[model samples]
Target chain A: MSGLQPCEILVVDDNPGDVRLIQESLKDGRVPNRIHAARDGEEALAFLRRQAPFESAPRPDLILLDLNMPKVGGLEVLRAIKASPEWKTIPTVILTTSMGNGDIKGCYEAQANAYLVKPTDLGTFSEMLSSIQSFWLTLATLPVG
Target chain B: MTQTPAPAISPITLHLLLGDLPGLATCLLGGGGQVLEWTEGAHALLGQGREEAVGRPIADLLRIPAESPLPLLGQRAETWSLLTRRDGSTFRAQLITLPVPEGHLLLMHPALGTPQPKEETVRELMELRQALDESAIVAITDAKGDITYANDRFCRISQYSREELLGKNHRIINSGYHPKAFFTNLWSSIARGHVWRGEIKNRAKDGSYYWVDTTIVPFLDASGRPWQYMSIRFEITERKRVEEALLEKQAELEERAAALARSNADLEQFAYVASHDLQEPLRMVSSFTELLAKRYKGRLDTDADEFIDFAMQGALRMQVMIQDLLAYARLSNTMEGTQRIHLEDALDAALANLSLAVKEAAPTIRRFPLPVVMGDLSHLTLLYQNLLANALKFRHPGRPLELTLGAEREGGHWRCSVKDNGIGFDPQYAERIFTIFQRLHSRAEYPGNGIGLAFCKKIVERHGGRIWVESTPNQGTTFLFTLPMDRSPS
Candidate 1:
């Protein structure tokens, strides 16, 4: 853990408030991490592909995605990441407010690393983010980028 | 002009003429108007046998006045005169004189101011024939299947002249609409001397189609063989048209009803989906307001704290209302989870779910035996939970609450009821209480989103049941519902 660099996390969400709250929650965690935000699924794809303006962006250690959005939805992004040879090794987690059975089943079938419903309670929401940081960033081993 | 001499008469010709006028009395007269022969008909009519009055003068037998001119030898005449019977009784008669080979044949009969019976019979036959021809399309065919008689109505309806119809069979009017078996059955029935009645489609000379209700009667000879067939027909084209139009209208109505049902189902599905999506934003509002109240209370001004509390309360209530709306819409969307379940077990599950409220209220509860019913078990549990929760929420403040749950078989259904000694409402509001979001009490008095009773009603109806309430203000209330014992899959 000492030799490793700070973890880079990418959060993809349409709502700016939700993205800010997630960043604030992850800041309280023990693991050293840097947060990068994409306003929607398209920007997240541009960052992942390192296109033009994002040519110097670092490969994200973990990706958090929202289900419902304006253009491309979370399920399609999950599928795109799992299909690519370069991005498939990076763990992608779905964190959305939809607790519907169909959404949960679809995300899992798309090879999402984990599925979490955004809790309505502020404490529970922060706690869920801390758990994701602890487990995906500190505990689990990943292939080096 | 000079008058021609009359030809001499022969006795044989006079005798043959007597047989011509059947059912009438006749006597032969010589050149002097004396009776030459008294026929058997005359004896029967005038009470005089031939032996008693064969040589009497025609005028003497008829009592004709002397001044009346006698009928001439070559002319025909008729006059009313009196006739004397052999018994000396006299009656008025119609005397007819026709020239014969001898002189004139005088025919006499009692004059009742009407035609003689023989002539009246012939006139009646002619009148009956005219009536049949005017009212019906009549046709007769000989034993060899050739048309022997066709009335004027038959020729008019067939669009053919009388000359063209005679000596021709009915094949000219065949429309070919009926199968071969139909005609075969008709022929066999008529050939067996049975009257056949049916509806037939026929074509006219102008190639127009028409429907007819027909009856054919066979006239048989002494050996029981049919000599001819008479067919009577009435047009039924208008009736057939009306029947066909009615069938088309009925089919159209059925299709429209099916389409309307499909649209209704689509609307219900839309409502369910819309309500489900509405929950996300509502949850965010509620969560943020709570966060504001928790983090800024006492740090902000007193007024700001109070305002945040109000906002939090509003968001929470809206969240509850939207959740209830989703539940109500879901009842219509997923009605397929139905099976046979024990009502007792369902009631137990409801009580278990409301254990906290039951422990807090400490209400006295009684349960009776319940029958097994075919329904969605979770829905039934929800129905019971809502009713029980209502009873607890509306319990009388001063007195201990009492609750009863019971069910019994009634015909093909089980009549189940939940009774409670609570603050009952007015009977007039019973029907409105089951409608979605209809509340009888203010939110300050009783806290509810007013959706429980609506759920109960929808669940019972989906299981082929009916639900209603009976209540008395300030006394008690009973919620009664019926569930069918057996149901076919829809």
Candidate 2:
């Protein structure tokens, strides 16, 4: 390990089981990373902006977003993130159960870094996370803000 | 009161008296009813002068018999007779015969109060009779509605001999399809000398039904009471049949359309509810089981690892199946989603969407110029993506994949085809392959829920086109579908 800082990943999902599954997958995978959680879109935005209770939250290197939530949806959060000059370059990956073309297109149009359909199988989900870890965190260069 | 008669005027003096009356034709007949003189009025009324009338037999000129009772009366007598004109046509005239010194002097004038001359009346009656015989089914009944005359046309249309119908009432052909009030209204109008016009359904002699457009006119007597009812009818059975058939077809079409709309609405709702509810639990099961496998793969036994893998694959496959079903159900809602789209643009979107697969297959795909079509752009994109992906997925083992995609105008639509040099199945399963979840090979060989072609078919059909396939085992497959041209040929 070339004395590099651990990668920070923020998982925003309304479903706690899905968030936990993702965290467990990341933990078991061979990746040096730290995982943060936001239960809904509102919390996701608050954490990203470091507002109120999240004032001391670290800026995430990557964001894994769920499309459906109680407040502002994944697309809206993506738009908000991309609209800000400071946060626009941060890679935001959409992880959604919706395989609809409109959802996929809308997420990309909002300037998401990538879109991934959440696999139903635990093994596939874990495999997808491992690939993401290797490709985005380990290999690919990212903007330092 | 008996009073003394005035002084008697001589017949010649009365002739002299009538000489000044305009349009009064006086012809003096000599012995044996022969013309003695033609007065000036006679020349004006008969178009014949004294030169033509004088010395001619008066009875012949007047179209009267010499044996008439008026000649035998031996005194002044007044009677009606037909007077011949120069044109050989006859007119009705009132003749007053006065016995004079040697013969009878007849004074002829226009018949009293008649609207038309006798010859014109005769011609009009004849024409009316001919018209009824050729075009109308006529029946004349006495004031009591008992049939007195049934013309040849009436007999033919009613399917009854004239002899059998001459004394029968109009009820003989009553079909009983109308209420009693219908006939009552008809009779009331005709009895009052007001013509009644309506349609009547009558039964023929062979028990078949016929329709007639009828007009019943009442002939009034001198006392202004109806003496006869003349009914003129025209057959309208064929026209009525066509109208009824058109109405029935319209009603059937409306009912079918309503049923289809209701079914479509129900399917949309079912798709929405099923997709939302079913995907939630499926996501959890699959995600967690996959996590279990990743976290404890080496720590668990081989059976445990295999069972976890099985559970994960089953849940994931079920999720795909549910998503496909949802897609099929959503097709019903896309009927109104149409626009003018370029086929090449849609294909481009599909190729871009399947970039990963296309890169992996490393296949040679040739695309030609495509025509513009009318349909939902997104749906068309999906259609092309699915078929292209299918071609890539089913590539023959140990052989390089090659694809040809192009479109050409066929009749009123563009017939587009995708030919692939991939593993082709038996032609017998061609129809089965398009059915939902019908797979030609094991899942291990090719991965699909067998809904792609069906989806393509639905999209094509929604745009008023059709889809078909041609293939041979171990060779290749070609999928052909059609999309209506932007505008039909003029």
Candidate 3:
């Protein structure tokens, strides 16, 4: 096997408060990576599709998504990205404010990589973020694109 | 006794001795009962006032006259004779002869009404008779039950003429609707001089049957012995007819209401059985597929192995979705199990189960004062599992996530919220996500069965509560649901 590039992560969300918290919580990762940001699912999908605005976008090894969004929701973006052959292989984690059974069931049916109910408390949110970072970066064997 | 007989007491002097008599008339009868001088009082008292009394013999004056009381007096002259005045008034008079002179003096005593008038008394009696005629029915009988009088109302109701019914026995109008004993008892009471009140069925003179409620009273003489019986009656046919109709309608309504309740119970039972039966096969499919993946991991080609993994994952997801559906169907049953549960402990257990995942995700989990709730524990546990696991599962590649859980009391319930900062979804898609198998992502992007929120919905409903969500893409997400916080028994 030839040597591969390091796995990259893409985060699609509009809230700066959430962006700050996620950035702060994911500290204990053992992977060689760069964390990128997209304001919405549409932007995230555009990045993955190698569109004009995202022409120099690097292929994301993993994606962390929000189900709710302006223009393109996390579920729609996930569906669009997963249906495209070029970006279908990337793992996506759905982080959303919905705890309803229907929301969870629908996310899985639409082929989300993972579904998570977002925690509001700063302490719980940090722990949850750190754990996710640890699991995906240290234990997970994500493909280097 | 003090005066000597003088002037031989002429006829005029004798008339003066009987001064101011109401019908005083002097009559002088010569020897051999021949009339000589007869006083006017004599003729005025008898209506033998025919002036023929002046010269007639005494025997002729005592003869019966067609237009006078003379006829009655003539029959029984010595004891008492009736004298009729011009106004149809009568008086009782007795004659005594003076032995030496062979003359007569009449002493008169009249019953008060005889010389007065019968005009007012006759008028009052006539009015009473008219009132009786207009009443429902009135009949009078002697103590022996033979008819003596019947008012017009009675005659009309019975279709009988007064001539035919005046002396007839009461049995002549018997309808025979009542047994013989009923009549015997009624007669027995009346014979004992007691009033008898009852409903009687009678046959009319024209052979028609009619019913009347009657009250019969016995009239008594001075010695309190029964002399006559009077009966008044009324008809009651319409009242009886209405009572019968009402009784029938009430019975029919009671029967219809019972049947409707039975049908409603049956429909409820059908829904419970249908959803329960459908869940069994889905569970079997998922468990076996999971087994195949665990057992045969490395024995297949890459594409084949991947396909199997995808198939098993899909089956597991389907199983979760079906279970959520079953939970929804059984909500009515779960409501019965509502009880107080320790939220602190429930949260600890949820964290414990996801401990490995929590450390792996490294999310900042903060919990505030959580309220205990009235809920089904097993269902609540399932709901908590999905929510906690969800918090840890969705994390951006580099950014940290913050989660806070809190509660507020409102409307007799605690509205609990779980907040998280990750890749939050948009507000518009919030309503669409909480349905069974309603996924918002593709298989390659996320790995989940997508039934967690549906389970939360079922649990909230079981507690007689509601759940909803609010979020903005790239912003934070918040989930809210309500539950009774103090459903403890007193």
Candidate 4:
């Protein structure tokens, strides 16, 4: 058996259904990965900074962020992530229900690694999450945390 | 009257007779009609004594008739004559003749009254010529239009010398601006003995152009044909230039006004496209619902599954509403395509589109006679569909749903009404109910995004019309709108 370490992914979304969907999609994905969840942008940033409750949490190799959330929306979190020297290397992908051109360009301008719109159909949404896992976590190599 | 001969007087007899007469004026003439031997009364009457008069001729003292022959010395003669004084006054007299020692001695006596006519016509003609030369550009052309006479003003304005201009046809100064027909008309007018007056643009010897207000008067001969033409001209080049500039400015202002209208139309198109871009986010939400329902269908518990089902339904409803809004925003883009539309046809289309909803509500639609109106064809269909759908959607729960669709002519437009016997809204919220996203009822009571009536209002207003509502708490609701009968641009 190949003894590669399991990839760590942090999913940030305000909707509990969307966060649960991401977790289910990754659990059924072909890659060996561990999925973490944050209910809002504030919690996602806290985990990324390893502060307090997140001190014992493993450093995530990837982040899937929603544009809209309860506090500290995706653009502010993306900016905070890229601005810090510690967490700047993590690949942050934007996944949201908004396919607006302004939102897409705003994320890219704020140094988001990639932008993707969440699919509405359950089958397509699972396929997209699996593809994200296969491409970012399974194939790509990451720096030591 | 013929001259009659007078009685003769002898000179020796006259000297013997007049020597004794003190008042007798006598002159001893030399061979060539000179005078001599003046008497004292003669010197006083003639104002010339013997010293001044002795060597002078007798003819100088008299106004002699040219036809009368002077008699020789010692000849008998009688004729009427005049004697002039040195003070320039003259008196009529009778001539007396006699023979003398050397020349004829003559006597004169006052006869009667007559006046001499003085000549002043030649001087008056000179003053008239000077006045014409100073004021007007005078030119005389012969019957064949050749230059005969041109005054100083004409020469100065034409920049041509008199020697160079004379005998030349009027064509030498033609600027070639006027067509042949223009000159032909002028010739025809002048040929019929009428004075031809017009403004002529003429070229000078220096190749510069000038405009002249001209009047050509034709002089006729005894045979009634024109013998010559006299032209009087005044300069009007400066006035013509100002008029041309004003016309150019007027044309420029019209062009600018047309450009401004085009720019306003472009801005309206931009607004329409920008609203169309909002559809993307609604589609994204719809897609998300489909994904959530498919992924978590049987895996989630009953409550979670039901909640997901509700979210999917809401997303699908929102998607439909946004499509309607997109169609509404695009109305201005097709405003140019609006034409005369029949209200009956619009209502038919609306009924077709809402047949499913109509079947579910089981509403009784009673349509009265409708009229034709002017509006965009597709938009008119959408307008009717929205109103009709609202009528069926908001029906009362207990009683069977009923709808009354009718139209009538109101002044210059067709006023249409869609009334429903539904759970009618309050009269206070009538205006607010038509606003987008402003619902009077919650989702449990009525499932809608509240955009239907707003679309109806926009469509009516864009067609140069109006839309309004009348309703009570539970009796019914009537949505009335107007559409212009005549084809008019929004």
User: Candidate 4: RMSD over Cα atoms?
Assistant: 21.2
C-alpha positional error of residue A108 in candidate 3 after TM-score superposition, expressed in Å: 41
Candidate with the larger lDDT of 2 and 4 = 2
Please state the interface RMSD for every predicted structure, separated by commas.
1.9, 2.0, 17.0, 5.0
Model 2 bad stretches (over 4 Å): A1-145, B1-3, B7-132, B135-150, B155-209, B212-236, B331-336, B359-368, B395-404, B408-411, B488-490
Q: Residue-pair clashes per candidate, as listed?
A: 2, 5, 100, 8
Q: Candidate 3, which segments miss by more than 4 Å at Cα?
A: A1-145, B1-336, B487-490
Among all candidates shown, the one with the greatest TM-score: 1
lDDT tens digits, residues B1-490, model 2?
A: 8985553776677766775578687767787766776788887788877887778887666566442434525598887665668877666677787777646777777765453356768889889899877889999998888898999988887899999898788788999899999989998898888999999999988888999999999988545789789999999999989988999999999999899978877876887788767988888887777668767897979999999989988987888888888878877675566767889988999999999999999999898898888888888998899899889998888799999999988888899999998888788887887877888878887777888988988888788888888998778999999987886343
Indicate which candidate wins on DockQ.
2
Candidate 3 residue lDDT tens string, B1-490: 5985655766456655663466444455555555555555565555565466556665555642332332122222433344445445454444433322444433333433245336687578678867766876888898888998887777877899988888899778998889999989998888778999998888899998777889999987545667789888776545544665787787778777677656744544664465455444443454445445655778777887798778776665654554555556555455556678878776777788788988888888888998778776767776777777766666566688788988899988899888887677878878777876666777578777666786687677657789999887776778898888786764
TM-score of 2: 0.57
Model 4 B-chain TM: 0.43
Residue range A25-143, candidate 3, lDDT tens digits? 55444445567788897788778877869899998867889877888888898888778887787878888766668889988998987898665334566577666766766667766
TM-score of 1: 0.64
> Model 1 scores what on Cα lDDT?
0.84
Q: Share of real interface contacts recovered by each model?
A: 0.43, 0.86, 0.00, 0.29
In candidate 2 the C-alpha lDDT for residue A49 amounts to 88
After superposition, candidate 1 runs with Cα above 4 Å error: A2-5, A99-102, B1-260, B487-490
| DockQ-derived CAPRI band for the predicted complex in model 4 | incorrect
